[model samples]
Target: MIQIGIVGVGTVGASVARILEENQDIITARAGKEIRVRKGVVRNLSRARDVAIPLTDDVDEILDDPDIDIVVELMGGVEEPYHVVKKALEKGKAVVTANKALLAYHRYELQDVAGDLPFEFEASVAGGIPIIKALREGLSANHIESIKGIINGTANYILTKMMTEGVDFGPVLKEAQALGYAEADPTFDIGGFDAAHKLLILASIAYGIDAKPEDILIEGIEQVTQEDIAFAKEFGYTIKLLGIAKKVGEFVELRVHPALVPQREMIAKVDGVMNGISVIGDKVGETMYYGPGAGGDATASAVISDIIAIARGGKSSPMLGFKRPLESGLQLLERDAIVSRYYLRLVVEDKPGVLAKVSQVMGEQKISIETMLQRPGEGETATLLLSTHRCEERAMQQALHALFGLESVKERPVMFRIER
Candidate 1:
């Protein structure tokens, strides 16, 4: 029997305990042993939880128990979870976590600390999608070229509503929060940080890279207006917050931002609170994984899957699905180095020379406008919506800088990348 101790007993942890008990027979048969949750740790022991397992306020009881073979840290945080996981690994107990932020920063260090011990985190990325296992095992033979994903559900849900219902962001965000798709403080989910954390995990596995969240370019969906959604529809595109990682020779580019993806693409059709990831490899071409991105039962399913792997005595793979640790010498391509089509919205003075001034700045940067829209202003300013042909981000930045200096331009321009 494999005795398990779950710390946290919150939504995910409680779900893990329930699923293990409900599916005990099948899980045990598949795991080649009886997997049992001996104890669970929670802040308030008096608080009634759904799971039948004994709950305790003391974390040490589980950690100190000699019979507990595996310690599941569902606790969500950086420092305390880090210390708990570190201590659990030190005690020779196998560790499983769903904390992406903690792992994103300290994965390599934790991997070193755990050494030969099993340290599994299948649930850390996309909720129930086994993208991590697929990359680590199924596509093990191929060299990962790039990974593009709609990893966060809150942003996707908001964008979907904005596009389909023609609603603005604020109302949709409120609706999402009411539907339990978003948090009270939705910054972590809507700001692209959540997706960025997941992307860092995938990047490390695919490229052997240990890049931090601060090292990558991250843009949120706060600026995606209803007009932008309408423009995307007119151009046959869908707007989504995407976590993108691409390898160019030795250099790897990493970013999380709202993108205008082709309408026909599978990822573009993934709506509501769902997740999808498209991974390109040398041999596999392009492969996609899609499923529910978050929820108690869905995420818990993934955590239990990792537990079953441990119960079956699966060993950690040394290659870790990459050739070696990503060399620091391998340049991380800056956002400015990226080349893509762009969507630009500018509020300008409704004057004849205004267009000429904007065009001149773009001309100096050699950026060609592919499509343009002009709407008469409610007041003294008009809205100019323009799409540009493939251009370097650096050139676009330069063009925007020069355009801002123009006397005809009213406000800072809103720009979004067009993903082909």
Candidate 2:
């Protein structure tokens, strides 16, 4: 029998406890043992829960217990859970976690601490999507080329509404919050931090590059506007917040931000609150994985999948899918060195010299405009929406800075990368 101890019996944790009992016979058959939830740790024990398992306010009741074989840490955050997971590993207990933030900061350290013991986090990246296993085992033979994903449901939901119904971001965001899709403070989701955490986890597994959230470039969709949507429609494009990881020569570029994806692409068609990931491998070409990114039952399904894998004696594989360095020659590319096509929006004074000045600044930075549109705005302001052919991140930054300093420019410009 495999005894389970779940910390933070919140929505996902309660679902984990319930699913274990509901699917016991089949789970036992697949796991080759009777799986049971012995106890769970919660902050408030007085609050009623649906699971029948014993609950406690103290964490040591489960962590210190001798019979608990698997420790499932669903508690959110970095430092507290890191200590909990570290201690759980120190006690020689196999652990499974859904905490992406904890892994984003301390994955390499925990990987070293775990050594050979079974430590699984299939639920960390995309909920109910078996992406971790696919990257670690299924495509282990192929050299990973790139990973482009829409991993956050709340942001995807907002973007989809913006694209389909032509509604602005504010109304859609409020609707999403009312529908229970977004939190009261939606910065973590809409600001791209949630997807950034998941992207870091995948980047570590695929490239073995150790990087924190702060180490990479992360931008939100807060700047997207109706003018930008009109430009996307004119150019056969759709705006979506994307988490991108690409292998460029010896460097890996990791970034998360709103992007203008071609409307004909499969990823662009993935609308609503659905999550989709497109992974390109040198040997196998491109593959897509799509599903609900987060929900109590969906997330619990992934947590339980890890538990089953551990129960079946599947512990020999390395936690990050590599024994040593993934590729010693490959390193993390600097944020300023990234190269891609871009879409730029500038609200400026409606004057003839403004376009000439903007073009001159871009040319000075070695940026060439491919498409352009000018729409009259309120008063003397006009919206200039332009798409650049291709340019380095440094050059784009320099051009934006120069444009910002110009007297003709009214507001700070908005830009989104054009994913080709």
Candidate 3:
């Protein structure tokens, strides 16, 4: 019998405790042992959670207990959990976690701490999808080329509603909150930080590149307007908040932002809160993994899979999937050096010279406009939606700066990159 201690008993943790009892026979059969949750640690002791496991308010109860073989840290945050996980590793307990932010920062340190012990975090990246295993084991033979994913459900839900219902971002966001899809403060998910953290976890497994959320270019879906959606529909494109990691020569480009994906692409069609990841490998081509990216059951299922993998007990691989540095020696690509086609939106005064002025500024940066769209706005203003050919991030910023300086230009320009 394997005894596990859950340190959080919140949504995902509560579900973890429930599923262990509900599916005990099959779980035991598959794991080759009787897996049980001996205790759950939550901050609040009074709040009732529907689980058979014993609950406690103190983390030390689980962490200090010698009976607990697996320590499941579902606790959120960085520093505190970092210490707890480290102590668990030091105490010679196997660990499983769903905290992306924790891994985004302290993965290497924890890997060193867990030298010979089993430490699994399949739940950290893509919720229920076994993306960690795929990148670590199944696709281990191939050289990973790129990873493009819609990993955050809140932002994806908002974007999908904006595209399908013709509603604006505000209304859709409110609706998502009411439906419990978004938090009261949705910045973490909508602002792309959540996806960025998840992206870093995947990036580590694939490229062995150590990066944090602050190191990459992350943009939110908050800037997307109905006008942008209309333009995408007109051009057979769909807007998705994408976490992108691509190999460019010796550098690995890691970024999270709203991307204008072609409508025909499989990833663009992944709508309505579903998460989809498209991974391109040199030997086996592209593979798509799609499923519910969040929710109690989905995330808990992933947690249990890690637990089961631990139960099966075998030699553990290096946490980031590499025992040594990659032979190619790929470093993180600089944010300004990123090159991609872009869609730009400008609300300008309804006049003839506005287009000419914008074109001149773009030309100065050597950015050629491939498509131009003009839509009537309130009163004497017009919205100019333009798509540009591939250009470096530096040049695009320069053009934007110059265009904003033009007296004819009103409001900051909104830009989204195209991923085809």
Local distance difference test values of all predictions, in order: 0.90, 0.93, 0.94
Q: Judging by lDDT, tell me the better candidate of 1 and 2.
A: 2
Off by over 4 Å in 2: none
- Each prediction's TM-score versus the true structure: 0.97, 0.99, 0.99
Prediction 1 global C-alpha lDDT: 0.90
lDDT of 3 by residue, 287-334 (tens): 999999999999999999999989998757888899898888889999
Candidate 3 colliding pairs: none
lDDT of 2 at 218: 97
Candidate 2, position 196, lDDT: 96
Better of 1 and 3 by TM-score: 3
Model 1, 182-242: lDDT tens digits are: 9999999999999999999998888887789999989999999987887888889999999
Q: Whole-model lDDT for model 3 versus the true structure?
A: 0.94
